[model samples]
Target: MVHLSHKFSTIPINFIPKQFSKHLPQQIPSQTTPPFIPFSQRQNQRSLLESQLISALNCCTSLTQIQQIHARILRKGFEQCCYVLTKLIRILTKMEIPMDSYAKLVFNQVENPNPFLCTALIRGYCLQGHVKESVFVYSEMRKKNVLPISFTFSALFKACGVVNDVDLGRQIHGQTILIGGFGFGFDLFVKNSLIEMYVKLGFLGCGRKVFDELPGRDLISWTELIVGYVKAGDMESAGELFSELPKKDMVAWTAMVTGYAQNAKPREALEFFERMLNEGVETDKVTLVGVISACAQLGAAKYVNWIRDTVENLGFSPTRCVVVGSALIHMYSKCGSVEDAYKAFKVMEEKNVFSYSSMIAGFAMHGYAYAALELFHEMVKIGIKPNKVTFIGVLTACSHSRMVEQGRQIFESMEEKFGISPGVDHYSCMVDLLGRAGCLEEALNLAETMPLEPNGGVWGALLGACRTYSNPDIAQIAANHLFELEPNAIGNYILLSNIYASAGQWNDVLMVRKMMRERGLRKNPGCSWLETKKGVIQEFFSGDMSHPRYGEMKQVLEDLLNRLKAIGYQPNMNSIAYDVSDEEERRILITHSEKLALAFGLLDINADFPIRIMKNIRMCEDCHSFLCAVSQITRRVIIVRDNLRFHHFHDGKCSCGNFW
Candidate 1:
C-alpha cells in the first residue's frame, strides 16, 4: 500500500533500483540442438540445491537470515550463479535491508551479469537513496555490453529525478526512443514512469509532453498523469480526469485524494470520497486518512468522530498499522482536541517511531511541553529510534519552555551520538530555541553557520526575538536574509517593522511599510472561531459580524470588558503600529482577535468551562499579558494556540511563563 512506507517496496518491481541486494546471473541461451542437463545427472543435484536456496532467499524477511543464506552461497562459491544472486537481491530490497555493505558484496560477486540483475542493482541504488551509485552501475552496465531493457532506462530516469537532474532525464528519454521501445505495448508503463520522473524533477511542461505521447493507458498511467496535473497546481484538470475514469481503483482514488489534500483542498478530497462511496467503493485506510484530514480542516469535531466510529466498526484497527493513526493524531491536534488525540495514542497496540513523534507534536501544540519532553524520553527508553522529526519535536519543546541549555545538548547530541547531521530544519529549531531564550548573538551565529541556506522561518524566528528584545541591528540582518529568500514573506517584513517601531526607529518603520506598499505586500488578516451555544461562529479582522449572534456578541464583549476591568484588568496596546489616543488604543486592543473570542466564550459557556482560542497568527505580547491578567481577574482558564506554541493562562500566569 502507498500509505505505509515500511510495509511494501514502493520501488516499481521491474525497475528495482541497483541498490537492492538481489543477485542476477547471466548464461548464454543454448541453441535448439544442445542437450539439456538430465534430472538424474550428478550436476543436476547442484542445480536442485541452487533452486531450493533461491526459494529460501525469496522467503527470508530478516537481514540476519538473508546474510546466513548469503554466507552459504559464498562458501559454496555459487556467488557468480545469476539465479541465486537475483533472489538474494529480492530479499534485501523487499525487506529494506540496509545498503552499503551488502550491496557492495553483491556487486563484487556478479560476473558477466544478466541485464535484469544489472538493472535491478541500478534501480535499487535510487530507491535506497544512493543516486550517484545507481548512475555508476548504469555506466558500468553500458561498458559490459549489457543492452538496456526498458526497465533499465526507467531506473536511470528515476535516478535523475532523485537528484533533481532534469537534463540527465531528458538525455535518458532520448536514449529510450533510440532503443526502439517508444511505441511498444508496454510503452505506456515506461513512458508514464519517465513523465512522473520529470514531474518529480519539477519540469511539468516536459512531463506533460511525455504524457500526451503515451499510446496505451492503465491505472498507473492515469495516476501518473493526474499526479503531473496536481504537481503543476492544475488540480482542475486532475479532478476532471479523475471524474471521467471508467474504472476506479484504490490507487487511483488515493492518488487523487492525496493530491487534493496536499494542495490544501481537503474539503474537495472529502467530497470526492463521498462520490467514491456512492459508486459502491468502500473507503480504505488511505481514503479514511484524507477524509479525517478534510474534517479536521473544517474543524468538524462531530464529523471526525463519525469517521472514527466507522473505522472501528469496519474492523480496521487504529495503531501503528499504517499512517491512519498518525493522521488521526494530527487531525485532533489541528482541531484543538489534544485530549482526544491522547486517548487515541493511549490505546494504540503497536507504536513505531512516528507514533510517538505525532503524539509529541500533539502535546506541544496543546502547550503541554512537559508532556512532549516526557514522551521524547519514553521514545528513547523503549528503543524507538529518533529521527529528524523527533529532534524537531524536542527542539520545539525547548523553544516552548525557553530551555536554552537543553536545546544545545540535544543539538550537539544529534552529531555526537546519533551521527545524524542537522538539516536546515534542525538548525532553524536551534535558532528558535536560542532566540526564545534571549540568546540573540548565539542564535545569529548559529544561523550563519547553518550547513544549508536558512529558510524564511529561521529568519522570522530571529526577527521575532529581536521584537521581544527591542534589537534593531540583528533585526535588520534577519530582514535582509528573509527578503533575499522570499521577498513577499509579509510576516518577516511586518516583524522587522515592529522591531524597529519598538526600538523607537519610527522613520525606519515608515520606510519599511512604504517598501511593503511598493511591493504590494499586505498584512494577512487575523481570524478567530468562537463556539457559541447555537454553533461555532467565526469573527475576524475588525470585529466581524457574520455570525448569527452579532448583536448578542457585541453586547457580550461590552459586558465582559466592563466586568473584567472592574476586577483590576487593564488593556495593553503596545502592538498597535500607528499612533492613537490612549483611550482609542485601549478601545482598539479590546477588539483584537483573542479578546473578541474570549468575550464570546464568557457569555456562551457555563462558568466552569474553559475559554479556548486559536489564532491564525502569533499572539501579540500585549494580548498574551492581557490574557494572563484576564484569566486571574475573571477566574477562567484561557487556552490559546497562536502561530507558535500554546499558552495556558490561569491566576495571572501563563504556561510559557510569558516567554512566548
Candidate 2:
C-alpha cells in the first residue's frame, strides 16, 4: 500500500477522453513480493539479511517483478512478515513509472490490517477522488481502536480540503485536538492544518485565532497564514503580511500574486510577479496561474505572447496549458480582439470545461452569438462536461441572438438533465433571455421563483425586461427592490427614470430625478469610444467639445442628419417625456452620446468600413430606430454594443429583429 500525492488533471472527469490511458505506461507492477534473504540463524545474519532482501524488493515495483517475488517468497515461507508487507506498500505506492498495478493488487489482498496500510490506502482513495471512502476508512480505523499518528491525521485533513466539506473537516479538527493539545505551543503541524482548513472554508477569524496560538512557527506556518488571508478575500492584509515575511517560499509568492488578481488589483499582481522572477525563485503551476489570471484581468494582451514564448523556450511541460489558454482567450476577449481569442482557442491541445467557458464568453462579449454557439457545440462534441458557468456563456449567446427556443432549452437542462441547480447567475441569464426576446411575463415569473433569494443582478435583469417591453408594473416592483438593496448603484436610478419617461409619466420622472439629486447621486453621462486605424482609441461623451476635431465632427453629424432626413427618415420623439415641447425633444435627441461618437467616425473613417460603437447603457428606443434609418441612408453597417446586446444595423434594420 504505497501512497502517492495527488496528480491533478486539467480536464474534467467526463471530458477526459478515452485516449487518456495513452499518457500512462503500458507495463504494470504486481503487489506481492519475495524476500531475498535466505532463512537461516536468527540474530547473527539479521542486518546483512535485511539489507539484501530490501534491495531485491526494491526491483519489484512492476506487477511482473512483484508477482515473481511473491512466488519465490511464498516458496521460502517468509510472506507473513509485517515489515515485508510495509516495504511492498512503499514500492507499490511509488510506482510512478507505469501502471498503478500495485494499487489495484494491494487493496484486493492484505493479510493483516495495519494503520500504516490503511493510511496508504486512504491516500490512494483521496487522490482518486473517493473522498467519502477516505473518510470511511479513517472512521473504520478509529472503530478498530487504531489511533492514527500525526502523518495519518494530516493526510485525512488534506482529503477534507479537497472536497471542501466544512462539516466533515470540522469533525477532523475535533479528532486532531482530542489527540493533541489546544495550545499550538506544543506542535506546528496541527495548528497549520487547522488554519489552512479554516481559511479555505471562509472562516478567517478562526484561521487567525489558530495562527495567534502558535508558540514557535516556521516559514511554512507563515505561508499558511498568507494563503489563508489571500483565499479569504483580504488582499490588503495578505500583501502586508507577505511583504513582512523574512523568507518567502514559492507557495507564498504565488499566493500573494493570486490574491491581488482575485481582488481586482491585477496590475499590482503582475508587478510583483516580475519582482519575484527577478529574485530568481523557482516557479510552478500556481505561479503561472497567478500570472495568467492577472493578465486576463488587466486586459494585458502583450503578456499572452510572452507567456507562450517563455513556456516554449524553457521547455516546461505544463499540465496547466488549459487554464492558461482559457485566461489568454479571456484576455483577448476583454481587450476587444475577437480574432486573437478565436486563434488561441483553436490551438489548445486539451480543452477543459473552463476553456470552453472562456471562449464562449469571449464570443458573447463581442456579439458573435453564432460563433459562440458553434464553439459550444464543438465543446460538447469533444466530450467536455458543461457546468453552470458554461451554460451562462451559452444562455448569453441565445440572449444576444434572440434565439428564444435555444435559450429555454439550456435553462431547463441545467437541473432536468445535468443535475446542476440554478444559481443567481443562471437566473440572471434567463431574465436576459426572456427580457431580450420580449417574453416579459415568463422572465418575471422565473425571477420571482428563483430558488435562491434574488440579488441585485437578478432584479436588474428583470427591470431591463420591463424597460424593453414598456411594462411599468414589473418595472416598479423590480425598481423598488433594487433601490432598497443597492440605493447607491447609479444604473438603477437611471433605469427607473427612463421607464417613467418612456411611459409619458412626467411627474414620476421628475420625482425620481429629485430623489437622485437629494441623495447626491448624479447620472453617469453617456459616453463611447472607437478604435482608430492608428491603433489608438478616441472617446466622446454627450455634449463633448474637447476633441481637436469637434467642429469638423459636428459638421459631419449635421450633414449626415440632413441626408438621412432626405431619405425619408423622421425622428421618433415618443421616448421624450410628453410633458416636454416638441422642439426640446429634437434638440435633446441630437445631444445623445452615441451620436457624438458616430459623427467622429463618419468624419475620419471611410464610408465602406462599418462604424463600430460601444456604449455604456442600453440604447433608447428612439436612438435604435434613428440608427436604423441612418444605416439605411448612409449605406454603412453600424455595430453598437449597448448595455444589452450587439445591434448590427444594415439595410434599414437591426440584427435584434426589433426585439431590443
- Clash number for every model? 15, 9
Per-residue lDDT tens digits for candidate 1, residues 219-249, read 7777877877887778898888888777888
| Per-residue lDDT of 116 in model 1 | 79
Q: Report the lDDT of model 1 for residue 217.
A: 68
Tens digit per residue, CA lDDT, model 2, 532-600:
645455677765577898788778777877887787767766444333588777766776788877877
Candidate 1, residue 140: how far the Cα is off, in Å? 6.3
How far residue 130's Cα lies from its native spot in candidate 2, in Å, is: 12
| Cα RMSDs, all models | 8.2, 9.5
Inter-residue clash pairs, candidate 2: 1-89, 2-89, 2-93, 28-63, 29-62, 29-63, 30-62, 30-63, 34-69
Q: Given candidate 2, what's the lDDT at residue 191?
A: 67
Worst 10 residues of 2 by lDDT: 3-12
Stretches off by above 4 angstroms in model 2 are: 1-148, 151-186, 212-224, 231-233, 247-250, 276-321, 347-354, 378-385, 410-424, 449-457, 480-488, 510-660
Error of 1 at 232 (Å): 5.1
